[model samples]
Structure formats: C-alpha cells, structure tokens
Target: MKSLNLYIFLLLATLLGTSCENDGDRVVLSGFQEAELKATATNVVLSNENSGKLVFSLMWDAGQLQNTYSERYGISATALTTTLQFSTQNTFSEVKEVVETSSSKSYTGKALNSLALSLGLETGKAATIFIRLKSSIAANTQSLFSNVIELTVTPYEEIAFLYMPGDLSGGWDKYTTKVCSRAGNGEYEGFVEAAQWNNFKFTTEMSSTSGITYGSSPTDLYALDDSKDQWNIWFEEGGYFLIKANTNAMKWSKTAITGFYVTGEFNGWNPTVNAMTYDSAKKLWTVTCNITTTLYGIQILANGDWAMAYGDDNKNGELTLGGANIVINEPGTYTITMDLSNPEKYTYTIK
Candidate 1:
C-alpha cells in the first residue's frame, strides 16, 4: 500500500509538470467574435443590383496574432450555392524558426455564407467560419452580440444622364432615350433631348416617390459612335447608342441649327441651315438637312451647367441654374423672365 501511494503521487507531479511546459512557452488567443466586427456599404447600382463592394473591420483580443501573420490579416470571402463563407487562419509559425511565429489569413471577395475564423485549440491552423444572422442563430439571438452583418449601399450620383438621341429619322422625328444607372436605385420615368449637341435647348421632367417633380437637362450622348469603338454594339435594352462622326460645325438652337458657312460654300449652298426642334409631346426632333453627305456624325458631350440651377425665378425654393445666376442685393419677390422670344435663347431670374 505505501509503494502504491508513492507511485500515484509521482505520476500526478509528472503530468502537472508536462502541462506547464506545453502551455507556458506558448499562449493562444481567439481572434474576434461577430459582435466585434463591423461592416459598411460603399456604393451600389441598379442595373448591377445584387452585387456591390463592402468593407469590414475586425477588433478583438489580438494579443500575439497581429505579430504572427506575415501579411496584414488576410481576408477572403468564399461563395456557396446561396451564401458566402469567410475563412481565417489564426497564427502560422515558420517550420524553420525555433521561436514561436505566426501567419495570418484574411477574408475578401463578394461575400454571399458562413464565415469561420481559426481559434482555441485550432490556433496556428485554418478555420472555416459559419456566418449566420443573429435572428437565425439561437446562440447569438439571446446574447447581446452580433455574429453576422449586413448593410445597404448608396450610389455615387443621385441622378445620371441616360438618354440622348443616337440614331434619328431624317426629319429627327422619333428618338430613343439612352439609359444609365439611377441614384438610390430608383426608377427613371422619362427624359428630354436638345435639338443639337452643345446647345442646352432641351427640357426634362422627373418625379421622386414623394410626388415632387424636377426638371432635367437635354443630356448629350454625342460621344457614343462606332468610329471611336469604345462602346458595345448598340443595344436598345441595355441603353446604348451608335453615333455618327465628322459633321459640319453649326450653331445649335433650341429648335434649329445654323452657321455651316464653310461646308455650305464648299457644296455651293447657303451658309445657314434650318434650326432643329424637339417636340417634347412627340419625343422627336425634326430638322431639314438640304446639304447632304455621310460626313455628319454626333459626339456625346459631358453634362455641364445643366444639373445646377432651374427656372426658380422666385428664390423661395432651391435655385437650380437652368438659366444664369442672379446677384440679388435686396431680398423680396423678384420677377425673372426667360427669353422665350427666341427659342434658341436662354433666360432666367436671380432673386
């Protein structure tokens, strides 16, 4: 009996010493819990609705993990049939190094399932994380912790120009409005066009869910042409256009174009061409082109001065600069009139 008791005491001491040696030199810490993670939405688009860029950050009892990984924590987002999985590597030690070392793995990509991070006994190993919403996971539901995250994206621009006439009938009577991504993932009901490029002679109307109506510019889609070969083949459903090139330089008007003196003289014709007019109700621009040649083409110009002000003669509302800016020294009701006498002219009020 004395010998048996002595043996048991020696065994216990040996086991305790072994455990201390293994755990003393090395300490492992779990990365972070879902509640500590944060995600934010940067941007989104309607045409490309389901996909967007998201940025997330992690914070936890980093302790030794930060120094173990050679690279900044690596992040990778893996896609499953219907979801995304985030995977992480805790700490990777170099095989050659005697001193403890660590390597890190991160998550990136279009996150669509479950995400797992290596932790606990899995230290210095890879971990596949299961991402589940707090509402779905009973472990996370009652706990005051967040296991999964979601956020809605906002767009860079609230409103964008989608349509300008690309191909038109000889009379300029029928046209298609070009399409682009809308702001806030909203719908674009309708658009207007100018008689010609560079001339701001078009009208536009748009309304939000609030039932408030707003005027827009006759955006120019002149740059879209086969000559440059930048855009895809003209697609009606996709809102693309094929444009012409090398047309006579003419002065554009709200309803007409003129001053083709050089081309007119070369072709033994008059210098002035008829103005082009866009019938909003008809959604068409009609013009008479007497001097004929295939050299005529349209270039898409940038939207300038169109989005700023509107016909806010009374400064009671936000002044969108459809016309010019006014210097109002005194505050009161000011009558600003646009030059309607000539459809080709621009007019507005300052006060």
Candidate 2:
C-alpha cells in the first residue's frame, strides 16, 4: 500500500509539473499588449443617426488598468444599421449595418451640408459634403468619453444674364410708299442715327387723320410725276414719329401735310415721295427721292434742278428771281422763304 501511494504521488507530481511547463511557454494577451482595434461597417445610413455612433475603436494604456473605446471615423447611433463588434483587450470596436431610404419625397438618406441647399441650385456647380470624426473611450468604463464629429459643406455657382439695352417703346417701324415702294428703317442700322422726340410722348398715336399729312419735304428736291405717285405710309406701332436735329444746318425740312382720307383713298393718291435719314457722325440728313417728269403733261419752262422752280407758290404762276434756290447740305432746321419779304418760315425736320 505504501508503494501504491508513492506511485500515485509521483503521477500527481508529474501531471502538475507538465501543466506548469505548458502554461509557462504559452502567450496570452489580456491587457498586456497594446489595445488597438478597428471596426468598419458597410451600407451606412446617416439619416436620423447620432453623429458620434461607434464605427471604429482603439485602446492604449496610459498607466493604470481600464477598458476604453475610441474611433477614427464619425460615429452616430443612427448612422449604423448593421453592426460588428471587436475588442483589443481593454478596448471595444464595432462595425454596424445601415439602410438608406428615399422617404419624405425630398429627403434622401445623405448628408445635406452643402451650398446647393442654401441657394436652391439650378444648373451650375456641385455642392460638397463630408464627415470626419474623432473619438476617445474613457479609461474608466463609467467615465464620460470624448467624441467629435464634423461636417464640411460647400455650394456651386455659374454665370448668367439679367437685362439687355434698347428702347422698349420703339418696337419697329414699317412704312410703304406709293407705287408699292418701301420706306423707313424697320431695324436699327449702324449708319442711320436714331430719331429723338423734343416734347412728344413716345406712346402717342401719330395716325390721326387731322394730326400730320404726308407730302414731299423741301429736302426732297425731286417732284412726283403724279400726286398719286408720292404717297407713303409708315408703320410705327406703339411709337410716334420723332425728328432729331443734326449739326449741319439751322433749318429743318417740313412736309406739306394735307387733309386725310380713308386708307384706300390715301393709297390711291401718292402725295409724297421723300424720306430723309440723319447721320449723326457725318452731320448730314441724306434724302432719297424718285422724281418723274410727267407733271401736267408739260415739259414746263422750269429749271431741271427740281428745287428752284417750286418757289412758284400758286403752282400755276411763273417763277420769279426773288425765289432763292435754297440748297441745304447740313444738319439743322430749314424754312422755305418763298415769300421772302413776308418772312414766313416753314419749319421742317431733317433728323
């Protein structure tokens, strides 16, 4: 019995020795090694999620023994839907799952810290959004942790136009002359100077039958073959005719305005044939005319120079030397002193 007891004691000693030997060589990491763990989650939804929720964790001892959790990414309890948990001895890390939704119609499961939200973007630059976070788990499990999450936002922009320069009131002018000839500057031309109003309203109607009549102005030296050959109509809708003075002369050309008849009758009687445009740069109002020689079927005893003989006021009387063959070459107002001594100056516009 003593030998059997000795053998059993030997067996027990051997077992204890073997166990100690195995344990001495084994390496176990509790809080001994550096506590560093990283956690990552896929499919993250930031909507309604706490911005500081755990997404990663790391732990490092500062002296005393304690468990702590920290992250390198922005964490939000709401940002993580799926979850993963890991630990570095004293540190805890987690990877979470999340779901993105298009609910609320206008609300998307994405960060909206950008300029696009502020200005209501149309079609320009793209806004930017980013999230960054830093967290430190407390040394004491019960102590409060230090965590931070940041968002950066930016807006987009582009170039655009507001308004253009032009007179809105002067829409367009369309005029037709007798014999189906066309007249007037319907479109703005670089060569022709624009007409200016002295005291007339731009919105007035110049189509009144009693206001003004159309006949050849003195500037138009050419005479029409027939009264029916000189009529001209102007289409200045929404605006009235305005005459501006040039720097050339002191007299403005005037049109012989007669009584108004219906449009058909007006068209039937070509009362005038001259249209003049002032060139501000050159200080001249150029006249355009078509003069035919078949008046009264007589090659009348008058100078071929259309202006001189017209001083015959009665149209039937013969020309007298007292009449001045007034030729205007500059920009200004002109008055025909046919009855010179009378000093009756007829006002005419050139510009």
Candidate 3:
C-alpha cells in the first residue's frame, strides 16, 4: 500500500514538472526565442479597381503551441491570442491591431487602402509600413513576438458610403432607394421619406450575403452595433426625416424633416419658395423651375436648411455633400431631377 501511494505521488510530481519549463512536450514560451514571420507580398499598390483582390498575407510559425499538444498554451490553447499590428515606423511609435488571434493575416486592396488612409498615409503615394506579430497568453506576460516585415504599398482615394433600406426605400429592390452620402469624416447623411416609418438598417453594401450590417443596439435605442442580425432601427411615426450616421461614434440619429426644396441663385437662396415635389413612383424629388434669367448655382436643401445639402461640386451633374452650387445655363421652365436612389453615387439632372 505504501509503495502504491508513493508511485501515485511521484506520478503527480512528474506531471507537474512536465507542465512547466519543458524539454519538448509542454514548452512554455519564454518570449525569448522569437517566431518566424513570412509574408506573401512585400511590395504592392492598392487601387479601388483591385480593391476586392487579396493584396498580401502575413503568416507566422506557431511551433507546437499551435498544435495544442497540451492544454495551457501557457494557460490553455484558448488563452493564447495572436495579434497583428501595423506601424509606419520601425519603432512602432503608433501601432494599430489589424488582426487578432490568428496565425495568418491577410488584407485586400480595399482593406489595406482604408487602413493606410486611416493611418494618415497619403493616397496614390508609395508608403512603407511595418508589421509584427504578437502572441501572448495575457497582456503582461508570456508573450512571443515575430520578426518585423516591411511593405511598400500605395493606396487610392475611395469615398466610403452606407446604405439604408427599408419600407421607405422604394420596396428595397428598386434603384431609387435613398442613400446616405458621406457628409464628413466617418459621417453619413441622407433624406428619407417613410410612409409608415417601418424597419430599416444600415449596410455597407446593398446585398445581403456579405458586408457589414449596423442596427440599433439591443440595450440602447440610439446607439448602433455592428452585427449581421441585430435590432432594426425604428421611428416613432412615418414621415420625412434626415437620417444621420456616425460610424466612428457608433450612433445614428433621425431628424424629422418637412420636405426638400430647391434653393439656388434663381430663388435668391430662398429655401422655402421652391418646394420640390416627391414622385412616389420614381422615388425622387423633382421641380419644374422657370429660369427666365440666368440661374447660377442651385443647391438641394433638406428641411429648408443647410444641415443636409447637395450640389454639383464639379458641375458635372453628380451631387456632392456641401458641394459647389449647380449652375443653369438654359433659360426656360425646365424639370430639375434630384436622384438619391443609388448608393455610392448621387446625381442631378436639368432638363
């Protein structure tokens, strides 16, 4: 009985010893022997034309730790987290965690372009970035790092947009659905007319299969959360509203609006005089204006205010938020069409 007890005690001690500093079986990463990082591409250029294509991939050797030979990759395989960081300087003065808890990290042209621009990298210009991997059981200890990799990538200019579709957006399949254009940095704004103010949510894309979907938080009504399935944003009643979304702040607001108006040099900038007519079938705002005189610069105003306004910045028919006023060259009663239907592209037409 004594020998049997002694054997069990020795077995436990051997197991405990094996759980710590190891000869090979359960080696606790000391954060000294660094991991090896491999990159698929070290140099490339990013453009909206190739935004969907994979730009590059960075992978690291996780050694036996990834194999999960034992529980507790420090504490356990589940506790080990790998983070991929981005930095412009080798010193990593400013670092951003691009990926987490992954052995490999990949970026597409769009993803990399957005990240580079968010990091203050100039568009269409070559810029160098450094990437490093960090594997740690916790924030303060047992961390393993990989050698840094350098990349030279050039990103392009692409204005981000958000899509809002619901009962108000012309049955959800029509091209006439109103779009919330990029108003400012991380901000979006649009004018929507809801007959019943039913269900609606924000999407990064028009489709349902992929892209991000943002909706009202389950806990807070005004706050927004990023989820594929979440609470649909609601309104108290059905009416015209100026919808605003700030992705950076993760909040959305719907301001009740009366209607849209055509305010320009022709009306002496009087927003209230020329009320634009809403065509329910076409889901657009239209007005037949008699420009007996030369009308230079016309702007579409929401709720008779500049809070949400659209004009042709380049005078090329396409509308822009707070853009330069649109000019009318021909003099006569002409139909001005304001189309806010397609997302990512808004335009106006003068007939």
Candidate 4:
C-alpha cells in the first residue's frame, strides 16, 4: 500500500509539470472556429412588384482575433476583415466580392434582381449562386474560409440608361432623339445629323419635359446651364456632326467628318474610289477589299481627295497624316476599319 501511494504521488507530479510546460510567455494558435455565413432565405424569386421589399438578408460574424490563446499571452491583434463573395458559376470562375464591416447585409427585390442579372443570370430563369465569407487578420495569415452556401434565385428584367433628345431633327421629336452615351469619365458623345439648322440640346430621358434638360448657359454654347428655363445651342452650318460634351472641363466641341474612302493599290491609289460606308451607331468607317498583291500600300483619305490623308507609318495600327504606306502581307480578302473617335489619337483595324 505504501509503494502504491508513492507511485500515485509521482504520477500526479509528472502530470502537473507537463501542464505548466506551455504556461510561459509563448503564444501559439490553439484552435479557431471559422466565420459561418447565413442567409434569411436559400431560395427566392425577385419580382418587380415587390421591388421595394427586402429579398434576403445575409449575416456573418465579425472576424476578430480574440481567442483563448490571445488571453493566455499578452498580445495585440491588428484589424481583421471579412469579405463576402458572390458568383453565379458553381466553380466560381468569376466572382464579385464586397467587403463588409457590418454583421448583416440586406438586399431589396430590385437590388437582388440587378445583382443577379449583372452576374450573368437570365431574366425569369432560376439559377443557383454560390456565396461564402473569407476572414483574415491584418497579417494576412491564417486565412479562414467559410462553407459555401447556394441560393437559387429567379430575377426580373431591369435596365437603366440615359437617352438625349435635341433639336437636330428640326423639332423636339422624341422619335428622332439622338441617343447619347456617357463614357466612364462623365463625358457624353453622340452623333447628330443636321439638315439646315444646328439648334440642339441634351435631354436626360426620351421625353424632354419628363426628365432633366441640359442647355446652354449665359457663357457660351459649350457651357451647360442646369435650370428649367434653358436655351438651345445653335450654330450657322448644318451637317452630319459629332457632339462631345466634356463636363469636367465645362466645354464642348463639334466636329464634322463628311466621309472617308480608301485610296490604295487595291483601287489603283484612287482617293475617290472604294467609298467606305460609315456606321453611324458605332461612329466608325469600315470597308472590305480584295488584295491581289502580298505587299502593298494603303491610305485612308477624306472628301474623295487628298486634302486629309492618313497612313500607318510604323504599321502599328495607328494613323498619321501622310504617313508611310501600310504593308499588306499574304494576299487575301480583308476588312478594314478606321476609328477617329479621339481627335488626338487615330487607330485602324484590319482583319
């Protein structure tokens, strides 16, 4: 009995010593539970009727490194972030991610439908989307990924656009409104065919009275005036022209390009021959020609004359006035395109 008691005492001492082995100033990752993402509904059909209503709400825990290990050892952790990922493809071939500091995110019917459509889902068709959460500390170490959740959603059709109507059609006819497209830099560009007058203005919608109208200010035709009483911008000459509004610089320019034609070996270097057709919608000139020579020269001239000529000097798909002849390799049929949208830079595409 004495020997057995002595043995038990030694065993208890050994266990106690082993427990205090890691009780020093060392910090280690003992264990952690990844952030789990949840949603209010796994299946929903977004509708226009319920456009204002909430479709679903996503909830996830804020990532913070405050585990028992941090408490055991005095150590401060940097800011942690949680990002939510959304993808229509099951394999997540393309993903749209949103970083959220809030614990919950809610989407309305219209918002969800727009998101679904933007993610390549068809309208009125049910498709599944994958969503998950990724959490990591400032160190970007020990990244924790949550389980992916699938949501089947049916979306509605919705399109947002701005159409400009002006007096280039002789009157304020919404039917003849010249559709203007805004670039990413807030500049508006469009084509207008004027017959005998150049009085024009931009409208925010198809109908002028229903939406906002932008017109000339007291400064000049280029300046914009934001008011109910707006003046129409006008000029003397009337022709097919391009109107560019630079809101950033508070200026505008009107350029007229009558026509473009190909003058090259294909047409015996005749500027008036092989008239290229102008694509009004795309604002480009395109032409197809047959080349009998493997190496030849081609030039794009204006007004069926050599008043303004462009050529590819370095064969780098760029145009320079009176540049070198463009070399053609391998005789075959090809389509050529001229892009003079930017007055400063001119480019061409041959395929």
Best by lDDT: 3
Task: Estimate the TM-score of every prediction.
Answer: 0.19, 0.13, 0.63, 0.40
lDDT by residue (228-324, candidate 3, tens digit) is: 2368887778876667777656788888867778876667888888888878668688888876656465788878888778788787889876988
TM-score of 2: 0.13
Give per-residue CA lDDT, model 4, range 1-351, as digits (tens): 323443443354455446756774323333234777889999999776877788888998655544334444322332455777788776777776666657787877755765565466777889998998877553425667788889999977644222444565546665354433222233556545565555767654456544335677766767765443357777667766666765334456777767778877767888777778877668688998887664567788867668568788888998876888777887778898987655335689989
Residue-level lDDT of model 2, residues 1-351, one tens digit each, is 333443443355455556656666321111222222222322232322422233222222212222122121112222111111211112323211111121111112211211122223222333222211222122222222222112222322211110101232232231110110011111100111123321111111123221112222234422111121223212233221222211111111222212111111112323232323434344333443222221221111112223322323333323232343223344333322111111112122212
Alpha-carbon runs more than 4 Å astray in model 4: 1-23, 29-32, 67-78, 138-142, 161-351
**lDDT, model 4:** 0.65
RMSD of 4: 19.6
Between 2 and 3, whose TM-score is larger? 3
Model 2 clash number = 33
What are the RMSDs of all candidates, in order? Answer: 24.0, 35.4, 8.5, 19.6
TM-score of 3: 0.63
